[model samples]
Target: MIGFGLRLTLRGGREAAVRLVVTAAAVALGVGLILVTLAGINGVDAQNARYAWLNSGVTDATSPTAEPSPDPLWGMLGADIHDGARITRVDVAATGPRSPVPPGIPRLPGPGQYYASPALGALLDSVPAAELGARYPGRRVGTIGAAALPSPDSMIIIVGRTAEELARTPGAAKITSIATRSPGDCTGCRFGLNADVLGLILAVTSAALLFPMLIFIGTATRLSAARREQRFAAMRLVGATPRQVSVVSAVESTVAAAAGTVAGFGLFLLLRIPLADVPFTGEPFAPGDLSLTPVDVLLVAVGVPLAAAVAARIALRRVRISPLGVSRRITPRPPRAYRLIPLVLGVGELAYFVGRRPDTTNGQILAYISGILLMMAGLLIAGPWLTMAGSRIMARRARRPVTLIAARRLADDPRAGFRAVSGLVLALFVTSTAVGVMTTMIAERGVPDAGPAARGTLMVDLSRGEAERGAPEASGAPVPDRVLAGLRSAPGVRGVTVIHTNPLGTMVPVGRWHMEAGLVACEQFAGMPGFGRCAPGAVAASVPPHFGAFDTSASSAWSRTVWPAAAISAERLRDLPAQGVLVRTDGSRQAIERTRTALAAAFPDPRWPPTTVAEAGADAENARILAGFQQLAGVVTVVSLCIAGCSLAVSVVAGLNDRKRAFSLLRLAGVELGTLRRVVVLESTVPLLIAAVVAAGSGFLAARLFLEAQLQYALRPPGAGYYVMVGAGLAVSLGVIASTLPLLRRVTGPETARNE
Candidate 1:
C-alpha cells in the first residue's frame, strides 16, 4: 500500500507542479534567510578572532578624572576626530602585563626601555635628541611584532616593558582598558554558550523578519490542498486505506520541501561569498567567519524536510475526505474566539513590561526580549481571527452579489485568506516598529551635546603646550594677545568673552590656609559646578584635591571644559596671573573665520586647534549603524513582498482547473462575468486590506511598548514616508491580485459549465 501511495505521489508531480514549486521555494527562502543571519554573526566574531591580539584589549595610562567621558570608545584615537588619525605625538605607553608580543616586536627588559613598531620608531627618530628624551623618556630597545600591528600606516605605538621594574614607578598609571575584547569568541558564536541581549536582539530580529516569509511559504504548500484532498478521497473509495492516502500526501510535501531546502542552501552559499567584504564595526569580515558549521548545515538539511512532512499531515486533519463528499467538504466553522488568546496574552505581557521596566540585568533583558516575542507571536496567532471578523463584518454590509460572494468565502475560510496576506502583514509590522525605534534614536542624539556652549555659540581655546611646540622652526605659534585682537576686529562680532587659565599659579587666602587654584577668567561666566562660568570679571576655579599630576582638565576647546578665574582682558595677562585666552564668541561663521585668520597672523606657527561650538557630522558613526540595520530590515521587507506576490499569484492561478466546476455553476445560475470578477477581486483584496490594518496596528503597539518597557519615554512616530511606503506596497499587492481576476472569466465560461 505504501509503494502504491509512493507511486501515485511521483506520478502526480506534474499535476501539482505549481504547488510543488511554490512550497519548495517557500522552504528554500526561509532556510536561506536564517543561514545568512548566522553567517553574518559568525563572520564578525571570526574577524575579531583572526586579529585577536589587536582587539584583545587596550589599556589607558591616564590618571582618573572626577567625571568620566560619556563614551570612551568614540574618543579612542586622537582628540581631533575630523582628521581621522593624523597625530604628531605617538600616544605610546606600557609597563603592564606581558601580552603576546607580535613576532617582529621583542619584549622590553626593563622600565625606560621600549620596543616600537617600525612605523612608530621612525617618527620618534625624527624628534630632536635634546627634546626626544624629555618628551618620550625611553630607549628604543627593539621593534614591535608585525602581527600585532593594526596596519603599516597606523599612527599608534605600544611601548612594552617588564612589569617587575615598573611596579615601583610613581604616577605610571592612568585610565587603561581593553581595546578589542574576545568575549564574543569564547564560544565561537556571538550568542555565547548562553543568551545575551545583543544575541537575543539578533535572534528576535531574524525571527520577526523570516517568520512572515515562512507564512508565505506555508501558503504555497497549501495552495492546492483542496484539489489534493479530492484526489485522495477518490483513492480511498478505490479501496486504498487511510494510511496509504496519508503516505501519498506526506511523500508529495516532503519531496517538495526537501527540494526547496536544498535550493535555499545553494542561495545561502551564493549570498555568503559577497557579504565577506561588508564592514562591521569598521572592519571587513573574514570568509570563514561567515560560514556555518558542518553540523548546522546537516541539521537544516534534515530538519526542513521532516517539518514539511509534519505540516502536510496537520493540513489534512480538519476535513473528512470521501469520494462522494470531496466536492462538498465542510470546513470547521471558522476559527473562533479561541484565536484571540494570543492577542490577550500579548496585551497582558505589554502591561507587565510597562509596570516593571527592563534594566541592565540579564533577567530584565530576557523579559524585554520575551515581551517583544510575545507581541510578534500574538500577531501571528491572531491573524486568522482578525481576518475572519473583518470578513463577517464586510459580508453583512456587502451590497452587491460579487461582494457577498467574496465576503462569505472569506468568512468561511479566513485561514486561507489570512495565509495569503500574512507575510505582508508581518513585514509591515516590523518596518513600522523599526521606524519608531530609529525615530527615537535619531531624536535623542539630534545635536551634539558638548559641554556648556548652547545654540550658535562659537568657542576657541589654546592647549597648554601649544605655546612651546610652535610648528617646527617656522616663526612662533599664535599668542592669545593676537587672537583676541583679531576677534575684536572681525566682522559681525556680537560679543567676546575671554577666559584664560592663571599663569601665576595663584593662591587665594581661605581664612587660615591659602588654597592653590588654576583660574579661568570669564567676563560673563555661565556657571559649571566646581568649574565656574560667570560674567566677564568673574574668576571660577576648578580646584582639584591635588591638581599637580593631571592639569589637562581642559585639554581641547571641544573635548573638555576650562572655567573662569577672575575676569581679565588679554591686555592684562602680563599683569594678572594667567594662561592663554579661552575665547567665546557670540557671532556667525563669518566672524569665527575672521578671528581664525587673525589668530594665525599674530602667532606665526600656532599648535592649537581652534574649533567652534556648532556641531556637524557628530553623529556620523551612529547614522551609519542605523543605516546598516535599516538596510537589513528593508531587504527583509522586499523579500516578504516578493513571497507575498508569489503566494497570491499561486492562489489565484494554481487551482483554476479544480475550481472551474464551482465557478461554472455560479455562471449557469445567472452570475454575470463582472460579478464573478468582483468575487475574485473581493476574495483577494478584503483579507489583504484587513491584514494590513491589523499588522500596522500591532507593529505600532509593539514599538510603543518597547519604548515604555525600556523606560525610554521619548516617542517618535514613523513619519508619513513610512505610511507611503506601506501604502505603495499594498497597492502593488492589490494590483497583483487584480491581475489574476481575468482568469475567473475564462474558468466561469458557458463552455466550462456545459462540459462540467
Candidate 2:
C-alpha cells in the first residue's frame, strides 16, 4: 500500500512541479524565519546579558591578568587602602560654556572637582607642579566617609611619584565613590510574560511562518486531490473501501511530507551560517551555538515529520468521501468558527484575569493576549464581508469595462480574493508594527532641559584641596562674574539663588533589593520659552532608576525593588525638609540655611535667571540614540512596503492566468485588443485603489493610536509621516501594474491560446 501510495504521490506531484517548487520555497522561507527568530532571541538576550554583567558585576571580567590601569575621569582601577590618609570629598564649580540663559534658574555645576589626601594637597603647592599651575581649582572641601582612603582614591594622591611610578605601582591612590546606579532585578520582570522583546520576535516569526505554511499546504493538498480524482473514482468502482482509499491517500501525503521535511531540514542546515549574519537576527546561532540537545534533534528530525504527518492526515479527510465524491474542494466559509472560538476563549480568560489581578503585569499580559487574538478573529470575520462589499461597491460604479469584469470576478470568488489579499494584510501588520515602535521612540525626542547657571558654584576638589581664584576672564572673554552681573541687571533676571552641587551616593532598600540612590540638586524651573516651563525644588527622574532589572542572568529574586523615587525635577514637597544636614560640614540645619543665604546674597552677579535653569541633562548622545531608532523603523517600513507591492503584482498576474478563458471569450465577442488591455488595467487598478484606501486608513489609525498617549501633555500631534508612507506604497503598486500592461496584452493573443 505504501509503495503504491508513494508512486501515486510522485505521479500527482509531477503534474504540479511548478507549484510544488513554489510550495517548497515558501516552506523553506517559513522554516528559515523560525531559525532566524530563535537566533535573534538568543542574540538580544546575549547583548542584554553583557550589559547586565557590566552594570551589575555579576560576572567577573575575563582578563584579570592585565595590568590595572588608572582612569583620568574615574581614577585608578586597582589600588590598595592606606591608613590615616586624611581624605576629603569636594565639589567643583568650573566656568560653563557661553550660551544664552533660558527662562529658568541655571543647572548646578556638574561634578569636576579634584579631591586629595592632605599629604597630596601640600605636595601640589610645593611641586615643580607649581610652575605649571598644578594648584587645586575649587573651594576647601573635607572628608566624609570613615574608612581610610583607598590608594586609588583621588583624595589619597601619592605625592613624590613620577608618571611611571604611578603606572608600575599596584596600589596607587584610589577614589572610593559609590555609583548611584541600581543593579538589575530578575525577580521583578518588568513586563512579565508580555515581554516586549519576546513578543516582538514572536509576532514577526509567527507571521513569517503562518503565511507560507498555510499557502504551501493549501496549494499542495488541492493539486494532489485534484489530480487523483479520476484514479480514486476507479478504485471506488472496483469496490475499494473508502477507508482503504483514505489510507492510501494518507500514505501519499506522508511521502510528500517526507520529501518536504528532508528539504526543509537540509535548507536549515545549509543556511545556518549566513543566517547568523542577517540583520536583526531574531535569535542568534553562533557556529558552535547550533546547540541541539538529543531531545531537540529528535524533535527536529522525528518531530517535523510527525507535524507534517498531522497536516497530511488532516488534509486526507477531503479525499475520504469515496473516490466518486462530486466535489473536489471544500466550499469556503465565513470562518465564523475561527471568530467565535477566540471570542469565547478570550472573554473567559479576560474575565478571570481581571478578577484575579487587575493592574499587575499579569493583567497587562492577559489584556495584550486577548486583544491580539480578538484582533485576529475580528479580521477573519470581517474579511469576507469586506471583500463582498468592496466587490459590489466597485462593480456598481466601475466606469471601465475591465473594472466591471474584475469586480464581478472578485464578487464571485471572495475566497480567492481574501487569500490573495492576505499577503497585503500581513505586510500592513508588519509595517504598522515597525512604525508604531519607531514613532513611539521618536516622540520621546525633545530639547533637553538646560539647568540653572553655576557662576558661583563653589567648586571644590578634595583630591587636591588647593583653592584658586576664578579665571572668568581667562580666554580673552569677559569675566563670568561680570557677565553674571550684566545678565542680572538685564530684564528677566529674578531672585538670585546660589545652588551647590555635591555628588552624593546613597544606599536604598526597596522590597528585597538593595540599590544605589544617585542625587542631584538644583532649584526647579519657574518658566520657559516655546516648549514648556519648569521650577526650583522640582526633580525629574527616569522611569526606572536602574534599567538593570530586565536581566534574567543574575538573581532569581521574585520581584524588583523600587528605589530612590525622585523625578529629574519634581517639586520638593512640603513633607520633606527643605534643607538637610550637610554631609561633612559641622553645622545645624538653620546654620546651613544661614550660610546658603549669605552666599546667595554675596554672589548676586552670578545668579542664573529662570531662563537658563533646565531640569534635565541635555546631552547630544540622547538625541543620537533617538534618531537611530526612528531611522531603523523607516527603513523596515519601506522594505516591507516594497515587498508587499511585489507580492500584489504576483497575485494580479496569477489571477489573470486564472481568468484567461473569460478574457478570450470577451475577445471573441468583439472586444478590441486595446479595449481588452484597458480592461486588464482597470481590473488591477480597482483592487489596488481599494487596498490602498484601506491601507491608508489603517496606517493613519495606527499612528493615532501610537501617538495619543504621548500627546496628552504636549500640543501638536506627531506629524503625519504615515500618510506619506501610504502614498509611496500606492505609487509603487500602481507603477508595477502599469509597467506589466504591455506583457499582459500578449497573453490574450493567438500564440497564448496554442500554449494553453
Candidate 3:
C-alpha cells in the first residue's frame, strides 16, 4: 500500500508540478522566516548577554553617571560608552576573605578606589567602569552591592586615591550610587542582550508562520476540490467510504507539506551566508549550530502535517453532504452560511473593539487583530459583489479584446476573481504595515536635515589631547565655542538646542524619578536662536503615547515643583498618573528623586543649573550617538524588507499557477508570448496599484494620528518625504513581482494545454 501510495504521489505530483512548486516554495518561505527570526533574536540576546556579563558581574563598576567628555575603550580607540569593561563596586559584608583596600579613611571593602585624573575622568564619564590606572599611578578597585544598577542607567564609579579626590574629579561622583541614578535612558549594559528583541521575534514569527499556513492550506483545499473532483467522485461511485476519501486527501496534504519542509531546510542552509549579513551590528556570521535540532525537526515534521490534516478534514466536511451526489461544480450554498459569516465576524470584531479600549496595550492588540479579521471576513463575504464591481470597471476600460474576455471571466466566477486578488493580500498587508511604521517614524521624528534642509547640528567637544592627535595644526579643539560660532554663521542653519541625551539620569521637577528606558534624544532648546518655538518654561516631553504605548491621557507638559515649569517626556507616560512616575535615563526611580533634590539644590538661580545647557553646542557628543542609532534603525528596516520580498517570490509563483490555464489558452489562440507575459505583469500591477492606494491611505491616517497625539507637542510637522514611504513600498513590491514575469511565457507554445 505504501509503495502504491508513493507511486501515485509521484505520478500526480509530476502532472501538478507547477502547483506543487509554488505551494512548496510558499511553505519554504514561511519556514525560512521562522528560522531567521529565531536566529536574529538569538543573536541579539547573545550580544546583550555578553554586554550584561561584562557590566553586572564586575564589582568595580556600578551605577555610573554621565561624563563631561567621551572616553577611550580598551585603552586604545575612543568609544562614546563609559567603559570598555563593566565595572562594579560591591560592598562585601563578610570581611573574612577581605581583599586589602588601598589607603583611605578605613580599610573597609565598600566602594573605594585609587586612580589618576584621566582614568578617573573616563570612569566617571559613562556607565561602563572607567580605566582607573590610566589616570593615577595605582590601580583602583572596589566592591558593590549584590544588586547592580539597571542597564543604560548603571553608573561607572571612579575610584581615586581618596573619596575627596574622586569627588573633585569633575562632576558629582555620589550620583553613581544606586539611589541617585536616573530612570530615563537606562539601557545600561543589559541592552546589548535585550530580551524584548526575542519577544518581538516570537510575536512576528508566529504571525509569519500562521499567515502562510492559512494561505497554503486555503489554496491547496480549493485546488484539491477543483482538480480531484473526478477522482473522488469515481471512488464514491466505487463504494469508497467518505472517511477513506478524507484520509486520502489528508495523506496527499501531508506529502506536500513534508516535501516543502525538506526543500525549505535545504534553502535555509544554502542561504545562511547572505542571511548572516542581515544584522547590522555583527560581521558576516552564521550560527555554529545552524541546523535544526531533532526536536525542532520533529515538531515541524509533525505539526505541519497535523495542520494540513486538520485543514483537509475541515474541507472534507463540505464534501460529505452527499457522497453519491457527485458533480463537476458545487451548487451554491444557501445565503445563510455566507451572510452569517459576515455578521459573526463583524460582531466579533465590534465586540473586540468595544470590549478592549484602544487606550491600553491589550486594547490595541485586540483592535489590530479585530481589524484584520473583519477586513478579511468582509472581503470574503462580499467577494461576489467586489468581483461584480471590478468587472464593471474593467469592462468600461476593456477596449482591447483580451481585457474584454478577462472581464467576462471575472464577472462569471467571483471565486476565481478573488484568486486573482489574493496576490495582493500579502502585498497590501505588508505594504500597509510598512507604510504605517515608517510614516509614524518619519512624521513623529522628522528625518535628519542633513543640510534649509538641516534640522540641527551638534558640536562635540573632543579632549584637547585627542583633538591634537587628530589635527596637530589646530589648537585645543574647544569645540563648544568654535562649532557653535560656525553653526550660527552657516546658511540654512535653523535653531540650535544644545541638549544632552544619554543612558543616564537628569534632574527633573518632581522629587520622584522616571525611566527613559529605550533611548535618549536631545534636540534644540525651545526658543533657541534660529530654532523653533521654545520658551524657558517649555520642557521636552517624552510621553507614553510616543513610545507606541496605547495610553495617551498624560499631559503634554508637566509642572515640576522643583524646576518650576518644564516639559519632559516620560519613558513610559500613560493616562494613569499613579501608575506613572518621574523617569530617568536608566529607568531607575532614583533619578526622579535625584532630580527633585537637584532642582531644590539649584532653585532660584537665574539659569536652571543641573539640567541647563552648558556652553552653546556642548552636546555635540550626544548628537553623534543619536545619529548612529537612527542609522542602525534604517539599516535593520531595509534588511527586514528584503526578507519580506522573498516571501513575495512564493506568492507570485502561486498566483501564476492559478492563471496558467488561461495563459496557455491565450497562447493557443495565437497571442504573442510577450503580450501574455505583459498581461500577467498587468494583472499583478493592477492589484498592487489598488493595494498601494489603500496602504497609502491607511498609513497617512495612522501617521496623522501618531503625529498629533504623540509628537506635535515636542516637534514640528513632517516633510514631503515622510509621506513617500508608501510609494517606495509599492515600488519595491512591484519590483519583486516583476522579476517573476518570465514564468508567464512557460506555457506560451502550442503543446502547453495538451500537457495539462
Q: What TM-score does candidate 3 reach?
A: 0.54
Q: Which candidate has the highest lDDT of all?
A: 1
TM, every model: 0.70, 0.52, 0.54
Residue ranges of candidate 1 with Cα displaced over 4 Å:
1-14, 50-181, 184-195, 277-284, 318-328, 359-361, 446-624, 654-658, 754-756
- Of the pair 1 and 3, which is ahead by TM-score? 1
On TM-score, the candidate that comes out on top is 1
Ranking of models by TM-score: 1, 3, 2
The clash count for each model shown is 43, 74, 64
After the best TM-score superposition of candidate 2, give how far the Cα of residue 284 lies from its true spot, in angstroms.
Answer: 9.7
Q: For residues 201-319, write the lDDT of model 3, one tens digit per residue.
A: 34543553455344555555444343465566677678877777766666665676677777767777787656554433322223432345566667665765576556545644555
Overall local distance difference test of candidate 3: 0.41
Name the 10 consecutive residues with the lowest summed lDDT in model 1. 73-82
Residue 29, model 1: Cα distance from true site in angstroms: 0.8
Off by over 4 Å in 2: 1-15, 45-358, 445-666, 669-688, 695-756
CA RMSD, predictions in order:
10.1, 16.5, 14.3
lDDT of 2 by residue, 62-145 (tens): 123423223221112211111212222222121223311111113222333333444455544553432111322343243212
lDDT of 1 by residue, 254-315 (tens): 78888889899999989886766554333344455678888778877887777766766776
